[model samples]
Structures are given as structure tokens and as C-alpha cells.
Target chain A: MNKKITKQIKELVIARLEIMPNNMKVSIGSYGAFSKDDLKRHVEDEDEIGKKVVEVQMAFLRAIKEGKLYPQE
Target chain B: MPKRMLVTLPDHDITTYYLRAWGKKAVKYAEDHSIEVTSLDRDKANRKNVESYLSNLPFGMVFLNGHGDENTVQGYNNEPIIIAGKNESKLKSTITYAISCSSAMNLGDASIKAGAICYVGYAQDFMFTLDESNSTHPLEDKLAGLFLEHTNIFMSAIAKGSSVSEAYDKAKGSLRESIMVAESSGNRTILSWLLWDYYAFVAKGDISSRL
Candidate 1:
């Protein structure tokens, strides 16, 4: 993973996760644990450590195109 | 008589805790509708016990909650309860609904081919957001509910005699509506994860089959 690309991806995913109400955490099975702090840690870590954050971010974008969210306003 | 609904609820970690909390509603709904509910909760949600229950009982539907992969549905402590090549046949003649990561990609298909009437699950990771402040009370976590309630609704629909396809449709519809609500509320952050859940959802084999 390119360090620069990893940094950019980490910032993007974390920003998205920050949309959750304060005191909430996101859990992505088989990818990362439940704590937002843990997710941030993963995103800031090396490519191998933070790959899931990038994967999930990409999946989220893909879902948007697939219209899985429906009525994408 | 209503058919039996066998549910595996494992509560060993944060992930399983949310599942267990959401499964409560499903269990209550099953019982309220006079559907026989057999639960393998906590430590009871192990491979040996699950196999024993299936072998000894007559269940029309099976609900699994745990960590899993494309080829397995696990139980307490991530023990494999139903594996693609091993005990997938035990699901023969039942409608199986798994609330686990990536099991639907392969295990769902394997179960159907091995004899299951139908299979419903996520082809990829099953994701959710929880309120850490309400972590002790997962059921009361509204953020988590935005994700888990849909899965519970699917199981509830099945227990209430809806066809497999109908339940699947109902769940997907619920997901869409939830996303809309989230969007209207300006909650864009979790929207993608919610959509990811919706996209990963899958119902295969015997779509018309019902419990």
C-alpha cells in the first residue's frame, strides 16, 4: 500500500465514520473490531494493518453506484 | 401448527452481543405466533450442541448468529457449527438464515445444494454501527438497530408464515426505507455502510419455499 494513498484513504473512511452520533462505534465483521478508536488505529497503521478500512471504503462507494441505498439523494 | 424455528445466539463478543440483542425480538415474535422456538444461546451455541439439536429435532427454519466465512457458520467462540463440506447436509429440508460475515457467498449455496430448502444471508461482511454509550444495552442502541432490525424483520416475517422470497423482499425493502430515513436526517456517514449491508444481502434456492 502506498503510504500517501493509505493516508488519504484513512482520512476519508474516518470522516465518514465520524458521521455517526457521538459515542457510537461501527463494527465491520472480519475486517475490523467495534471501536471507532480501533478503526482509526487501523487506518493510521501500515498498509497490511489498515487494508480492511480501504476495502470497506471502496465497497461503500460501489454500493452507492449499485443503488443499494435506493433513492440516493 | 406453526413450524419450529431453531436460533443460535452466541454472546461472546461485541459482534455477537448485538446479534444476541437483536435475536431477542425474533425469539419473542416466534413464540408469540405459536412457532416452536429452540434456542442455542451463549455457551450452548457450540458445534456439538447445534449438531445434536438438528439431529434430534424437527426444525423448519434455522437462524444462525456468529462469526463465519464463505464456507462455515460458527457458534460460541467462533466454533464452526455448519461447515460446507462437513455438516451442511444437516440443514437438509430447512430454510436457513445466517447472520454472519460472508457465509452466504458459499455456505449458503452449499447448504441449498446439500438439501436446504432456501438460504438467506450476506455475501460479504455483515456490518453495523453501535452506540458505545449504549453498548451495555445493545437492544437500546438506535444506531445498531438501523442495521439489525432489518435482519430481525426477515426472521419475523418467515416465522409468521411468509414465503422465503417474501421475507427476503420485506427485509430488502426495510433496508431501503431505513436508508431513506437516514438520508433525510442528514446522516450520510453511516449511509454507505447501510447500503453495503443491503447490497450484500442475498436469498438463494427455493425462493418460494416457506417455513
Candidate 2:
């Protein structure tokens, strides 16, 4: 929730999005379809769409950390 | 009595264009299984038409494909069709699957309270990646299929007489399989988005209900 953590998460999200193929576009519901560059810009701006992207990234990280993404024993 | 389904396909933008194309599979599956389908497509996917059909028909299931928020799902050109506290009652006696963003957060609950048999949708943004080369032919875009295919699986399961809970479990299973594929492919973009959708997917009301 802090600004420093927020900036870090945004950087992480942008880095993850950068790996997307050039021909691929991500559609985030009504917020519209976004290219890799577009997603990076959204993360940098921290606007509504950017915030949502960050939230998603955070959720993924948490899931991994909690082993929720792993097969349950 | 034969099962009946009502679908709203609103294609006015890039996001909706893909939804409309992929949503057709569910419609087709229903018809092939002897379920009568009433398709309100494009401009016809408006509030007036949805209300008229639901109020006067015996549709047991409704598939809504479009942009939406926590309180409302839009139709063609983003015209609000079902709004929580306003038209949620129209969903009564129907199993509703809204392949839109965030409507499950509130509208799903409202519809259930209004007597809907079941409501399945995403509690957050329904995200997917599209192949721009296949933009003109969305159904051919395999990248988008990673997400939308699970939606089709859910509807198809329901048409096959699976209970709402069983259909939801099958869709979740499909998403898990895709997530494993994305992980093995080392595609962080796909993996992240698939995980997001997996967590956001929700089913409210009576999960035991069937069409």
C-alpha cells in the first residue's frame, strides 16, 4: 500500500507484460484491448487499468507464495 | 419441455468483437443439443429485447456476453441491459452466465436475491490475450481461446444437463489445465492472466440448479 511498494509492483508488472509477443493484445474487459507497450504505459501511469494489472500481478504472486497454484496434496 | 436459452451478443468494440465470436460456440452447442436458442445479436442485444424475451418466454438459461461492471451488464454499444436493483428480477427462474467483467461482484448476488436459479460470472475483469493477426477472425485466435474456451466448456457442460456446480468445476478444471500449459510454455503473460481469471471466476445462487 505504500508508494515505494506500489512503485516496485508496477515495475514488476511492466516487466512481466514486456515478455508478451508483439502480435498479442490483451483485452481487459471494457477497459479495452492493450498491446505490450500499452500495458507498460498503463502500469507507469498507475491509472485504473494499470492499477488493475498491478492487482492481478499481486494476486498471482500471493497465490504462488501460498502454494495455491500448486497441486494440492 | 425442451430447454430454452437466451443469449445477448453485443459486438461494438475490439473486446466485444472477440467475446461475440467465441460466445457463438456456446449458442451453437445449445442448439445442437435440442435446446431452443434465442440470439439477440449486435444492435438487437438491447434492453428492450432482453426484457421482452425474458418476460414472455420460458428461457431457462441466459448467456450475456459484453462489457460490464459490478452493478450492470451492457448490450450493443455499451447500452445497459441488466442493472442491479432495476432489472435483476428479469433473471428470475433462469440460470445466467455473464461472460463480462465484474458483474458477478454485485449483480450476480442481486439476481439470485431476485429468484435466479444460478449466476456464474467473474468477480473482476475477464481478461484474455488476442492474436492481432487473427483479429478479423477472432475464433481462429488460439491465444484468446486459452481463456474463452473454458467459458464454452462451462456452457457446454450445462447444455449436457450438468448442474451449475458441476459445470463450474469443469470450467475450473479446464482453466487449471491451461494454466499448467502456460506455465510449461514459460509465457508469463498468459500464465498471469489465466491465474487472474481463475481466481476471479465465481458462481452464486444455487449451484445445484440445472436447466
What are the interface RMSDs of all the models? 3.2, 2.2
User: What class would a CAPRI assessor give candidate 2's docking?
Assistant: medium
Q: Where does model 2 exceed 4 Å of error?
A: A1-5, A71-73
Give me the candidate number with maximum TM-score.
2
lDDT of 2 by residue, B1-211 (tens): 2399999999999988988998998999898888999999999999999999999998899999999999999999999999999999999999999998999999999999999988999999899989999999988888888888899999999989999999999999889888888888888778888988998899999999888
TM-score of each: 0.91, 0.96
Evaluated at residue A69, the lDDT of candidate 1 is 48
Off by over 4 Å in 1: A1-7, A18-20, A30-32, A46-49, A63-68, A71-73
DockQ of 1: 0.54
> Chain A TM-score of each model, in the order shown?
0.59, 0.83
The DockQ leader among the candidates is 2
